[model samples]
Target chain A: MRKQWLKWLLPVLAFLVAFGLGRLDSRLYRQPIGQVIAVKTVKSVKTVDNFDNQDRTTTQEATVRFLNTSRRGQTTTITNQFTYSGTVDSPLRRGTQVFLTKSSGPWRLSNFKRDAIVLALAAFTLALLMLIVRKRLWFISASIAVNAILFTLATHIQTDASRPLVWVLFSGLAIVFAVVTALFVVGWRPVCAVVVGGTVGATALAVGLGYAIFALTGYRDLHLEAVKYVTQSPQLLFFIQIVIGSLGAVLDECSDIAISIMQLDGSGKKRFNAGMAIGRNVMGPLITVLFMIFIAETFAEAVLWLRNGNAIDQTISWVMGLGFAQSLISGFGIVIAIPLTSLLATLAGKKEVAA
Target chain B: MTTLSALALTLLVLMLAVGGKQGLSDAFALLLNAGLMILAVILIAGGFAPLAVAAVIGLIVLAVTIFLSTTDMNVAGPAFVASLLVMTGVIAVVVVGVLFSHTGGFGAEDTEDLEGFSLTVGVSFQQVLIATGLLSTLGAIAEAATAVAAGLIELGDDATAAGRQDIAQAIIGTALNTLFFGFFGGFSALFIWFAKLRYPFWEVLNDQIFAGELIQVLFSVIAVAATVPMTMWVVGRRHREEG
Candidate 1:
């Protein structure tokens, strides 16, 4: 009974705190926050673009009550122009809270205050995790917190997105992430070394192979322009991505397989076979999971292209190319890590070499 | 396209080399799943309702990924049942995320690329966002179900207090490693992209691209955390009935 409260109490408190922050955090913003009191549509025009696609361009004047800043509770009229496509701007409804961007003289709609949803969903996720994980919840939460801080800090530090230093920086970060992650999973043991080694080795091998392939091919048709926002080398950006990208699944699979193999009783060959079975079991899921994650990022953009009359092959070339290549390379890490971990297990527990 | 095809071909060969017949079949299933996903995209692009296409195709993709990837009914069957139940929940969560967060359209970063392209593709980007969320997390949910089921099935008659630990490990591990880090891999460029543009944390949180990615990652982890209990219950029933 006491433990029941011990579980529910913390999560309930967390939910309240997060939800409260979501609701009342508006005062903390430097940008303007406002509630839409009235929206009057001043103009509406239907138009056709160069591609013969038809859309309605509508302009509206919104009366906003500022909730924050020195102009608190003040009303200002801001003009909002939107299209049905909402590529850049979407129509706002009355009673919605939004962030305002200050221009030379006029206040514009920046973005919606989405933190409420993020925190609310976060609270739900935390509560569920607490209920499910029970005692080990601390470890999971701590690892996540540490990793997030480090990830953000490094990204902040490497202000130069295209700098050569990122190779050194993220490579170091990858190892730190893997080692710390392995420790959390396996927690300070001789086997920790094995798990960490398998992950780093497999990840490095996969990413290096990807690098070699891209380089050897002269980076031909790699479609570096999907990320055209990157003024410099998107390829360098991609290199850092896959190196750290493949770290997650490979580490997961390695630790899982290694731990499972360590717990079994068998000769080298028998354990190797057992390890292979376990590895194969999750391999399918891991591959699908990683590849699908890659696909999802670019899917919306690719779909937009296709809907706008771009051909499938052309869409693949420009839209899906980089993500696809990343998936393949990261996938190579996962498939190869199975045997790599199993071999480590076989070697580690080589008490009986019945081979 | 050529680079991707070549890279995929190399992965196929490597899968065969490392995993052998099993690898070959997994590769086949993966290719088929990819084809289905692309087809779903095409269907949505062809003026079909995005959510409906997403729902129908997501079911089949889960089926093929679960059934075709493995031969063991003991693992695949319960995994499939649990996945459907959880997927229903996942779809609901994603719907809430898409609606409330409004993480449906292109971001300011996309302004340059999307120039001259009409947002009026005849389908709602909001619906497209929902479909994307529904489809992307399908793999993680399905995989988590299978892993939990696999662990429990291996436990067989000895399912007891200790079995709980194994199930917990499988569930949390899947969430943290594959699904969560998969987010990192998935959003790697975007993260760098944000940093490159010097968007502060507060501003980054409000950005469309970051918000969408954030919501998707949360959806995935929530699905995973939920999957543990659902799979244990579903698979636990089978164990009880048989024993």
Candidate 2:
């Protein structure tokens, strides 16, 4: 009975704490970045349908009350135009909070109460996780928060660097991420060693295979167009993306394979064959997942092309090629990790037995 | 050979080397799965509702990827049902959150990509965003559900001896690692891009593309978290019935 109460109570407590943090974070964004204001839509003068006939362009008059800076408590009237079809244009409704940006006279309305809503949704999801997983939520949450910080720091360190330096920094970061995450997830067990080994080993193999593929095709099919806002060499960045993207999935599959092997070894059965059979069982779904992610990321681009009456072959060549390469490379990492992890797990078991 | 063909050939060889017949079948399933996604995209471009198309494709992918991969109908059945339920719940939450966030459509950075495309392409970018979000999350949900289901089934009826709590704990631990690490691994490059370009914290958080990816990762993890208990319950109940 007490356990049941604790389960419910713990999630509630987590929700409150997360909510407070979210609120605090949102408040921090309100400080003098621009003219922070609360705007109420007074009226819409005209709503014109664009050439597409699916989206509307609206012209509206809004009454804005400045919330911060020297203009605090000041009220101003502004005319705003909603040109875009989607939610990129803040939906004009009575009494919506918006940020007013003033650059050389005209005040622009943007993002209607976005931060608060995002916070609410995040709080809800966190609470749901806490309720479902109970105490394990702490480890998962800590892992996410710590990794996010590390990723940010790594990104910061890699800024404005040469190609070679970028590679060195990212590789170093990947190793640190793999070690820290494995330690946090499984502790200093033999399984942890297997995970780290599998991750690094799989990553190395994937990078090698990726480079070989790139070389074999003379880099003809490489989609440099998909590379956006690249600060370093696009070729190197693309290569790094594939390596980094494979890490988590590789680590994930490695953990699964290693754990299954450990379990089989513990049973004192035909551990090697059992591990091989388990690997076969798990690989199918793991590959499916890797391909699914690849497809999902590119589906939008495919749809956009098809909508524009582009040929299916052209779409496949332009959009699907990169996604396919990414999925295939990541999938290879996962597949290779299975055997590597199994070998490591078996060796670790032997060591334990001898010890 | 082209890079794409070479990559395909290599993966096929590796798959065969690793799991042989099972690997070959899994490869076939992956092709079918990719074909379904393309078909769904074509349909959405043809004026079909994005959410409906996404949900249908998601279900079919789950069936092909999880159910078809396994020969045992008993294990496949529970995994399919549990995954479908979890996917549906997560999609609903994600769709609602997306609508509220207004994160759909192209941002200023997309101008280069959108140069050739007409803005009035008659398709709603909002629907496109939702579709992409659903697609991104389906894989993680399916992966977690199938893993737990497969793991429990392999444990056999004797798994019940360990108690439901023990099984749930073990599955949750693995599921969390798989989902969390997979997310970071996939998006590290994007984060690096943001930092290299010197995007401010607020801007990074508010950027449409970044937000879309963030929501995808969060929803995927939520779905995985939900799948753990659902799989435990379904498999546990089946064990009870058999006993």
Candidate 3:
């Protein structure tokens, strides 16, 4: 009874402490932190465009208390300008902890210092994990920790490498991801070799097919350059996107197929047919799941482009082009994995009796 | 053929060959879902309240995906109820996350590409992010809920304590892998981008783009985890009332 009480109490206690810590952690920052105490719109001007997009721009005055640096407690009123669309700027709200930049006169709001929210959400997640997963929570936590370490290591390598190394590192990472899922989650048996091999082989063929088709098509209307935020070669970056994006999907489907097939008491042909049946059940949802993610990830940009007068098809090409390409490539990989994994799992596990 | 069209055609054919009529419906449903997405985007860009359009479309999309995925009321009924319950909680988390994170607008990197685009669309970017967050998790959360409900139903009259444990284990195991590896795989490029720019760790933590994605992924984990117990409770209650 006491242990049950402790389980519930512990997470609540941790969350409160973490929330307080996150709010107070502003003192640890090198950048200026401004806590909005008061804000008011000083002026509002309306702009109407030919595209039927009409919105107002506003200038505001905000009184803030400095929470960091030598001026730890100074209060000042800063002028801010923002727009309704918030394409570049949004209105400042009370109690928002904003990172400030000092250029010449008044300090400017750059980005929000959102550690409190990050910490609170993270703490909430951990608490839920402890409460829900309970005994086997260690497995989940350990995997996440390992992922963090590997990601950090990959980033460190990328920093020194002349070119972006996502394709290379994640190819290695995909292999690791597959092996771990097979070994730990799927429980490594000799048949897991089939799972790992099938996943990797399908990914290679799918990516290669995608690449070949794109190359043959001359990369036409596909706007690789539209990918945001990079000085690296966009083509290679797109390649990296396809490779990483498809790996999990292929692995998930392959592992599912391999496990289900190995459990069946039948000849290889029957096992393969049963595998196809199970694979068919999942095929649609798996393909659409990734595609929906891509669409949502790019939705805001696509909307903005449309509002800005870009045609629908043009906006799609510009904003969702890479995402669509990645989705299709991953789609190809997932379909290929169904049969490939079935064949491998059928051939590897158990002696077959003639039917 | 255009790259998008040609590739889409190939995918359709492959799905049909393997998945047959069921795969074809799956592909068709996906197309319909995409159409809904585009319609929602158009409505928002036409100056409708982003939140309202998102809310309505979110419901319809959920129904479309859930009801279409199966004809079994036994599965779809419980799955739909559990999903709506989970979505309400998820939306609350998302609203707070978006409000505090301030990741509404396009980041500085997108500025170059959006140079000539007008910024006066009159729609709230925060709401847009909120909408996107809702849409993004629908597939995952719904899928998880359905899987749980379906598994429990498949157990039929023998949903003993041990059987429940087995189903829970299988569901959680798959959820962890699907959510974790999917995020890792999807975000690898962004990680490299962060490294190539050589942003400091603190800056990366505070960056709107990276922090937003990381926070949402954590929420996805919580949502999927929550679905298991929620689903069991929902199914259990329905059974009691029926009896």
Please report, in order, the local distance difference test score of every candidate based on alpha carbons.
Answer: 0.81, 0.70, 0.78
Which parts of model 1 are misplaced by more than 4 Å?
A: A1-20, A40-45, A160-162, A228-232, A351-355, B238-243
TM-score of every model? 0.93, 0.88, 0.92
| TM-score for chain A, candidates 1 onward in order | 0.89, 0.82, 0.88
Off by over 4 Å in 3: A1-17, A162-170, A351-355
Order of candidate numbers by TM-score, starting with the best: 1, 3, 2
Model 2 chain B lowest lDDT segment of ten:
B161-170
Pairwise DockQ winner, candidates 1 and 3: 3
> What is the C-alpha lDDT profile of model 3 across A1-355, one tens digit per residue?
6885576566557657776788798888999898999999899999897788778889999998999999889988888888887877767889878888988987878887877778877888787766666666777677667766776786677566665454576578767766776676566577678878988999888888887888778887888877666556777667666766666667777877888888888677999999998787776667666776777788888888888788888877878787778888888888888998999888877643332
Candidate 1 chain A least-lDDT 10 residues? A7-16
Q: Give the TM-score of candidate 1.
A: 0.93
CAPRI-style class, candidate 1: medium
Per-chain TM-score of chain B, candidate 2?
A: 0.89
TM-score of 2: 0.88
Q: Model 3 Cα displacement at A30 (Å)? A: 2.2
lDDT of 3 at A341: 91
- The residue-by-residue lDDT of candidate 1 on B1-243, one tens digit each, is 356777888899888887788888889989998899889888887778889998899999899899877788999999999999988988888997777776788887778888877676656778888988988888888888888887788787787866777587657864676666778756666786777677888888778788888888888888888788888889888878887
Q: lDDT tens string, model 2, B1-243? A: 778878878888888898889889888887888789888888887889888998898889888887768878877888888988888787777777677666677655566777767555556667877888777776666667776777787677666644555556655666556555555555555777788678877777666677766776667666777787787778778889888
